[model samples]
Target: MTKLTCFKAYDIRGRLGDELNADIVYRIGRAFGQFLKPTTIVVGGDVRLTSKELKSAVTNGLLDSGVNVIDLGEVGTEEIYFATSFLKADGGIEVTASHNPMDYNGLKLVREGSRPISADTGLADIQRLAEENNFPAVTQRGVYKQQSVLGEYVEHLLSYINLDNLKPMKLVINSGNGAAGHVIDAIEAQFKARRVPVEFIKVHNNPDGTFPHGIPNPLLHENRQDTIDAVLANKADMGIAFDGDFDRCFLFDETAQFIEGYYIVGLLGQAFLQKHKGAKIIYDPRLIWNTIKLVEENGGEAVMSKSGHSFIKEKMRAIDAIYGGEMSAHHYFRDFNYCDSGMIPWLLVMELVCTTGKTLGQLVNDSIDTYPSPGEINSKLADAKTAIARVRAAYEKDAVSVDETDGISIEYPTWRFNLRSSNTEPVVRLNLETRGDKKLMTEKTEEILALLRQ
Candidate 1:
């Protein structure tokens, strides 16, 4: 049995040989199966080279435990979540590192109805089982079967948007050689058949394990320029870029200006509320989103949640929220089992534009002005806890309210800040926002960073 130190607070992730390999992944599968005692398990993988081998090991282990495996080969992480809930499977796992470098790989697991399994839930149990290296052996092994859910997935996505009477627009898409290319292709084909006048500009649209361009994470300002450039160079209506497994997507307007995810959250909330009046929308507290205000004004309820996919999904399920979003570009939908999807957000936004007779930029420009935020700045610190304490100490004297749900959050009258330590990295992420005061936002950000650096 491996030590399995790679089992993180959220998922199992590690460098290829140093921490994870087929053997370790096989044991994880056995442990997961034994722990859940799942009747049927759904499995999928991204475009990484190591993913298929990991999937094979996992499936073999599951089969050995008398657990049937439904293989949805070469799909995105959200697809696994969707399939797990849609098919009412006992559990699901997706082999993906999700925007990590090529040498790293991991697995995202969930139980029935696409509920997340985090450290507090069942991850520790699985880790303990893996460490024990003992699994129940079944006399009769279960069977493995291959299935193609991509077409149905695409169709279901289209159902969320109205493609009927859409205007002709050029859309730029950079897949970054990840798992999103084929899904985009499938969706584009459907749009074509329905006579939706859309032209797709595809870049790096093939799945390449080496990630010749780089990791596909669009959160980095450096990684987003290509998509922005493509939008401008082609005079496209808009551009969208996807991360490694296509679980998160980023957008650029026709003018090549990157649209902040906060504004997108507001746009989506309004959209969802238009259909389902008074429905609840969930948002992370990192960015003091005016989106929440917008939701409330639009007669919808907005609830603050801790940052992270697992927490957001759990909160969404608990509240029966229709939609939820994080500033990191993760968007979740109740229809999609509250799982984050890189594919759904853009489609819905596009549909919003087509239905409203407005351009994407025009739709979100107002919200950007209302809620100016210091887009998540990360500072590497020697001690994250100390840095957080320093910031908290500075603000606690006159703070309106302070909460430590995920980290240190101090609320003032006009501005607020959340300094959160990352789960996987040695850095404190700072998100500051003000009630339309850009200068105060800048000053507070510098003040907090200076305190941390001190």
Candidate 2:
């Protein structure tokens, strides 16, 4: 069997040409078809230059396996999820590297109802089958057709907000030259068609696979300044930026201060609680106090799940949670088939701003003040486990509580931190949060880092 290194804990991603080319992707498509034996599958890709050809190759493989394919041309990852469930397709695949460098490309797969196909959930089986590169001959080939889901997708997104109350607001939207621009354009047109007031100041709005600005990853501190600068220059009510595939979005307040994803989790949770007071809200275990406090304060239940889309989505479905959020900026909605959408979050926040007459800053300022966090910090070491063990041992004595759902989370009376090892690298991630004390948060962050480094 030919060894393949592209498969990760969650999805398939690797450098282009060398690790993931048309031939390899074709085999993956065949393997996926063979493994699931689905009658119909949905396929889509991001704005990467190679995505089109790769998607075509994969679609051909699916067709060769006698599996019907619905091609959603050049879309965000969430679109595949939306189309899969919305079309009632048996399976789906998205050809996207999502914020990786230009030289990389990969896939994200989901089974029926858009349930994630992670390493534990049939991805490994598909990987092994692809590595074997063996397939049985089929007498007939499946059919293929190109379908546009943008109109329906826009209507679904609009369903999340009250059209009447979405007051005319000036907003700066930066697409980072990724696949998000098309959807934004569609939504803007929908707003205009409905006569709902919304003014969009678009930046890098074109879908450029070359990523003229940079890869659309606002998670990196360096890539955020452009969006922040645009928001301030335009004097917009708020700014939203999305990753290459647009499944994850980062927000900035009217003042152009980049809001942490941890706080956004709380903000969005509160927004949902307004309509469904007793609903359940799932959050990652990395940074919990803010989300937990907000959900509880609003007469909702807060449940903590391990970080990662598969786990978050699974927990959300299990508990019938209305929403799930990760501090890394992935927001999942039950209404969206338990899939995360970059579009839904900003719209909800916009509605909140219009209805409450509050700036984005005002909405999340209290959460930021109440739970100050030294956003996720990382350290590369020869032995990540040893580093995590060191931190756990050091804090085990003083911690009032410890949870190991995803990583080692140690809680104190007024402060807490979660030290987790990366799934893809030999590095440890540290996130520290304190109850209304920036000084203590800073001190604990450094103190924990010192121990992690030791």
Candidate 3:
């Protein structure tokens, strides 16, 4: 039994050959099958070059343990979620690294009803069992079969919006040479078949394991310029970019301005609240002023959750939230089994634009102006804990409120910031926003940076 180092707080991720390979993945599958003891499971993979071999090994492990496997080849992370719930499978696994670099791969696992399998849930146990690598084989091995859920998944996405209400708008979609191309093509085909008035201008739309156009991470400023440039050059109404697995999507407005996930959260919250008055909207603690204000003004309740997807989904399920969003571009919906989807967000945003007859930029203009933020900033430090402590000590006394929800969050009347250390790296991330004071936001951001340096 080899001890694996890829299991993380949320999911599994690691460098290709050194940390993860077919051997390690097979052990993980056996361990998962032994631990969860599911009768049947759904399996899928992203477009990563190494995912196929790893997925095959995982399937073999599950089958050897008498767990039937349903294979959905080359799919997005959300597709695993959908297949798990839609097919009523006992569990699901997607071989993906989600926005990680080229030479990395990982797995996102979920149990019945697409419930996330985090550290607290069942990942730690699986990790321990995989390390032990002692699994008694079943007398009868399980079976493996292929299935395509693309049509059903496309139908699920279209269920979010009324196609007749959609206006004739041209959109620039950057698949980032990842796994989103197939699904995008599926949806476009449906639209074309129905004569829906949506025009899609695709770039880097083909799924390439090599990632010839880079890793498709829109969070990086350098990675986002292509989408911006494409939107401008095509004169499209808006632009959307998806990560490797297409579970999260970033948006750009008609003006070629990148819309931060903070404002998009507010925008999406408002969109849902308009239909379901007094519905609960879940948001992370990193940036809250805009989301809180929008939810309350629209007759909806704003609930705050911890930073990670597991925490957010748990909170949403508990509160029966109609919608939940993170500043990192993850958007979850109640109708979508409380799972996040890169495809749903853009579809809903387009619906809003079509119904309101407003540009994407115009829809979010008020919120962006009302509460400006510098976005989340990260700083590498030798000692992140000491830096966090120092920053807390300096601001705690003068702050109107302090929250330790996921990290250290300090709030004053005009500005607020959250300082937290990364779970995966030796870095502290800072996000600050103000109630209409960009200058104060910038000043406090610098002040926080100085404190971190100290």
Which regions in candidate 2 have their CA more than 4 angstroms from the true location? none
Superposition TM-score, candidate 3 onto the true structure: 0.98
RMSD per candidate (Å) reads 1.5, 1.0, 1.0
Write one digit per residue (lDDT tens) for candidate 3, span 211-304.
8888979998888988999999999999999999999999999999999999999999988987888999999999999999989999999999
**How are the candidates ranked when ordered by lDDT, highest leading?**
3, 2, 1
Give the per-residue lDDT of model 1 (tens digit) for 216-295.
Answer: 98887788888888898999989999999998889998898899788888888988998899999998888745877789
Model 1 clashing residue pairs (backbone) = none
Write down the worst ten-residue block by lDDT for model 3.
419-428
Stretches of model 1 off by over 4 angstroms after superposition: none
The better-scoring model by lDDT among 2 and 3 is: 3
Which lDDT tens digits does candidate 2 get at residues 102-198? 8999999999999999999999999999999999997799999999888898888889888998888888999999999999998888888989889
Ten contiguous residues minimizing lDDT sum, candidate 2: 419-428
